[model samples]
Target chain A: MEILTQIFSLETLSSTLRMATPLAIAAIGGLYSERSGIINIALEGLMLAGAFIAVVVSYFTGIPWLGLLGALVFGGLFAMIHAVVSIKYHADQVVSGVAINMLAAGGTVFMLNIIFNTSGTSESVNALPYWGPFKPTVYIGLLVVFIAHYVLFKTPFGLRVRSVGEHPHAADSVGIDVEKIRYICVGISGILAGLAGAHLSLGVLDSFREGMTAGRGFIALAAMIFGKWTPFGALGASLLFGFSQAVQIRLQGLGIPTEFVQMIPYIFTIIALAGVIGKSTPPTAIGEPFEKGKR
Target chain B: MGVDKIDIKELAIELLIPLLAIIFSFIIGAIIVYTFGYDPIETYAALLQGAFGNLNRFADTLLAATPLIFTGLAVAFAFRCGLFNIGGEGQLLVGGLAAAWVGTFDGLSVVVHVPLAVLAAAIAGAIWIAIPAVLKAFLGVHEVITTIMMNYIAYAMVAYLSLKVLANPGEIKTPPIEASAYLWRFSNILDIRSYMNLGFILALLVLLFIYYLLWKTTIGYEIRAVGINPDAAEYGGISAPKNIILAMLISGALAGLGGAERTLGLYHYYIQGFSPGYGFTGIAVALLGRNHPFGILLAGILFGALSNGRTFMNMAAGVPIDLVNIIQAIIIFFVAADLIFRQFIPNKSEGGVA
Candidate 1:
C-alpha cells in the first residue's frame, strides 16, 4: 500500500507535468501549421534551434526570459527556411523537413564548438526559477493549450486557416490569402516549438546537450497526430506520453527492464497512429503546396 | 525525335540537376566557412586531398561507402514503389542483432556459417519491416510515422539485448563472431593493411541485381506502375497493396544486408551505435542519385569520400566535421525544393523524368 501510494504521489504527477509541457507546447505548434495547410516536420529542428539559442542567450545575458525570447526569434527564423522551401520552392515537405532536422543537428553542434569551445554540450548556466518543482513556463505552456483551443475554435482567423487547409481552391475563390495565412501560422508554430525548446533548456535542465531533445519533437508530432490535430486532444495525448516518461524513470529504480519502459510512449504512439486508440485524420491539404490560380 | 536525342536530353538534365545541387551545397558551405573565419578554398582543397590522397585512402572511402550503398539502394528501391522507408535504420539494427545472434553459435564451415548469418539478418530485417507494411496497407496508417516509431523501438530493443541478454560482460559489444561468419577482406588476400573487404563486391552485386529487377522483371514493372499512379494501377489490375508490401520487404532486406556487412565485415560484432546515421544519410543519397541504381552507387561513393575526409578536414582545417553534415543537409534541402531547382535549371521536370 505504501509502495502504491509512493508510486502515485504528487511528486510523480509533478514530474509527469514537467515531461508533458514540452510535448504539449510543440504539439500545439504543429497543430497550427498543419491546420494552415503546411506540413511542419521541421518541428524537431526548430526545437533544437530554440534549445541551442535559449542556452546560449541565457549563458551570455544572465537572464532566462531573454533566452526564451532569443529562442523564439531563432526558432521562427529557422522555420522560415522550411516555409520558404516547402511553400515557395515547392519542395517535398518531408524531404525539406528532414533537411531542416539535419541542419539543426549539425549546425547546433557546430555552433556549440564555436561558442562553448566544446562539441558535445554547452556550459552549465542558470536555470529558470521554480514554483514548487514547476517552472513558470509549465503553467504558461498548459495555459497556452487552452488559449490555443480557444483561438483555433473560436476566432475568425482559425476558420480562415481551416478553410485554407481543407479546400484551398474554395478559400482562394473566397479571397482568402492562403499563403499569407500559412506563413503566419507556420511562424507562430515555430515560435511555439522554440518555446518548447526553451522549456527544455531553461526549465528542465540548465545546460543544453547535443541532441538533448532526443526524439521529443518527433514524439510531440506523434502526439499531435494522436490527438487528431486538436489542441485539447494534443494536450491530453502529450500528458499521457509524459506520464509514461515518468513511469519509465520509476521502473528504472525498480530494476525492471527499463529499456522497454523507455519505449512505451513511442509504442503507444504507434498504436495511436494505427487507430487502436482512436481514428486520426490529417488536414486534407497538409502536404500540398498552395499554388495560386490552380485548382 | 530520335530515341538517341531524347536519351541525350534526359541524361543532360539528370547530370545537370545533381551537379547544380552539389555546387549550391558547396557554395553555402563556403559562405558558412568564410563567416566562421576559415579559408573556403583551402578547406575544399584539403577535403579533396583527404578523400583521394592515395590508394589506401580510396580504399577507406569505398569501405565507408559499402554500408551506404546497401542502405541507399534500400531507400531508392522503396521510393521507386511509392513507399517511404525511413525505417532502414531499424531494419539494419534488427538485422545486425540477428547476424550477431546467429554468429554466437558456430562450429559450421565457412560457406554454411556466412550464408546462415546473412540470411538471418535478411529475415530479421524483413520481419521488422513487415509490421509497418502491414499497418500501412491494412490499417491506412502512414508508413512515415510507423517507421519512425519503429526506429526508436529498434534502438531500444537492441540496446536491451546487447546490455542484458547477449552481453560479453565488461565489453561494450557482444562477443566477436566466429571466424566462419566473417566476410573476407580483399586486403587480407593481397596482404595489404586496409579495411577494404568483399562487402564492396556484395554492394556492387546487389546494385546490379536491383537494377535488373527494377528494369527487367514484371514485378518491377508492376511496382513502378503502382508508384506512378496507384489508383490507375489498381484500376488496371495491379495490386497496389501487394507491391507496397513487396517493396518494403525488399528495402528491408537491402538494409539488412548492410547490417550484415557492418557486423560480419567491419566490426565482427554488433557494437552499440554501429550505424552513425547511415540510414538517414541513405535518404539523401537516394535523392541525390535520382533514385537510379547507378546514381545511388555514385552518390554512395561520394558520401563515403565525404565521410572519410571529414575527419581529415577537421584536423587540417580547424573546422568541425559537422560542416560536412551541414553541406549534406543543404544538398537534400535543394533536392526537396523543386521550385528553386526549376528556377535555376529553367526547363527540366523532377529528377525521375530527368
Candidate 2:
C-alpha cells in the first residue's frame, strides 16, 4: 500500500510533467514537418545538436537564455542542411535523415574529444535559472501547443500546409509554393526541436551527454502518430507517455526492478500504436519526393 | 545502326556520375583530414594497410561483413517489394535474443540445436516485422512510423529481458551456449589468430539464396510488380497486401539469420551492445549495392573494410574511429543524392530510352 501510495504521489506527478515537456515540444515540431509533407526524421539529430550547442554556449557565456538562443540558431542551421539535401538535391529522405543522425553522433563526439579532451561528455556547469516553483516553462510549452493547434486548424497558411502534404500536385496547381512551405515548416520544426533539447540540457540535466536525446525524437514521433497528428492529440499522447515514464521512475524507487519499470513506456507505446493499426492514415505524400515533371 | 553507339554513350554517361561522386567525396575527406593537420596520403595508406595488411586483419574484415550481408539482403529484399523496412534493428535485436536463449539451453546435439536456434531467431524476427506489415497492408498505416516505433519497443524489450528475465542471475548477460550449439571457428584448425568461421560461408549461402529467391521465383516477380505499381499489380491479379507481408517476413528472416550467425559463430553468447549499428549500416550497404546480391556482397565487404580499418587507424595513426563514420555519412549522402552528380555529367541522347 505504501508502495502504491508512493507511485501515485505529487512528486511523481511533477516529474511526469517534467519528462513530458521535452517530448511535447518535439512532437509539436514533428507535427509541423509532417503537416507540410516533409518527413523530418532528422529531428533526433537536430535535437542532439541543439543540446550540445546549448551546453557549450551556456558554459562559456553563463547565460542560459543565450544558450537556448544558440541552440535555436544552430538547430535551424543543421536542419537547413537536411532541407538542402532532401528538398533541393532530391535525396532520399530516409537516407538523408540517417546521414544527419550519423553525422550528429560522430561530429559531436569528435568535437567533444577536441574541445573538452574527453569522450562524448561535457563537464557540468552552473545550473540554469529555474522558471519558479510552478515551472513557467511547462506552461509556456503548453501555450505553444495551443497556439500551434489554433494555427494549424484556423489559419489559411495552415490549410495550405495540409493541402501540400495531402496532394502537392493539387496544391501547386492552386498556386501554392510547395517547396517554400516545406522549407518554412521544416525550419520551424528545427527551432522547436532545438528548444526541446535546450530544455533537456538546461532545464533538466544542466549538462550534455552523448546520445542524450536517447530516442526522444522517435518517442515524440510516436506520440504524434498516436495522437493522430493533431497538436492537441499529440499533447494527449505525450502526456500519456509522460505518465508511463513517471510511473517507471516511481517504480524504480519502490524496489521493483528498474529494468522492468523501464519497459513500461515502450511496451505501452507498442500496444497503444496497435490500437490505431489499420485505422490511422498518414498524409498521402508523406515519403514521396515532389518532382515538377512527374504527373 | 546508330542505336548501338547511342547505347554505349548512355551507359558511359550513367556510369560517370557515380564515379565522379566517389572522387569528389574522397577529395572532400582529404580536405577534412588536411584541416586537422594530418597528411591525407599517409592516413589513407595506413587505412589501407589496417584493412588488408595481414591475414588476421582480412579475417576481421570478413567477420564484420558477415552480418552486414544478412541485413543488407534484408533491406534490399523489402525494397523490391516497395516497403522501407526501417525496423531492421528491432528485428535483429529480437532475433539475437531468441538465438541466445535457445543456444544456452542444454540437451540437444549440435546439428539439431544449432539449426533450431537459428530457426527460432528467424521466426522471432519474422513475427517482429509482421506487426508493421499487417498494419501497412490492412490498416493503411505508414510502415515508416510503425517500423520506427517498433524499434523502440524492441530495444526496451531486449533490455528488460536481458536484465531481469533472461539474465544469468549473477551477470547482466546470459550463460554461454553448450559446446554443441557453437559454430566452430576455422582458426582452431588453421592455428590462426583470426575469428573467421563458418558464419562467412553461411552469409555467402544466404546471399546466393536471396539472389535465387529474387530473380528466379514467381513470388519474386509478384513482389517486384507490386513494388513498381501496387494498383497495377492488383489489376494484374497479384495480391499486393500478401506480397507486402511476405516481403517483410522474408526480410526479417534474413536479419534473424544475421543475428544467429553473430551469436553462434562469433560471441557464443548474447551481450549488450553486440550490435554497433550494423542494422543502420546495412541500409547504406544495400543502397550502395543497388539491391543486387553480388553488389551487396562487395559493398558489405567495402564497409566492413572501412570499419575494420578504423580500429587499426586509431591504433597506428591516432586517427579517431569517428572519421570512418564521417566517411560513411559522405557515402550515404552521395548515394542518396546520386541525381545531383548525374546532372553535372551531361547525359547522352540515348539515355532517354528509360
**TM-scores across all candidates?**
0.96, 0.93
Q: How good is the docking of model 1, by CAPRI class?
A: high
- Which runs of model 1 end up more than 4 angstroms from their true locations? A253-255, B1-7, B346-354
How do the residues B197-267 of candidate 1 rate in per-residue lDDT, one tens digit apiece?
88899899999999999888999988888888889899999998999999999999889888998898888
Q: What is the interface RMSD of each candidate, in Å?
A: 1.0, 2.1
Lowest-sum lDDT 10-residue window in model 2 chain B: B1-10
Model 1 steric clash pairs: A91-B336
Model 1's interface RMSD? 1.0
- Candidate chain B TM-scores, in order: 0.94, 0.93
lDDT of 2 by residue, A187-251 (tens): 88888888888888877888889889998888787777777788998888888888878887566
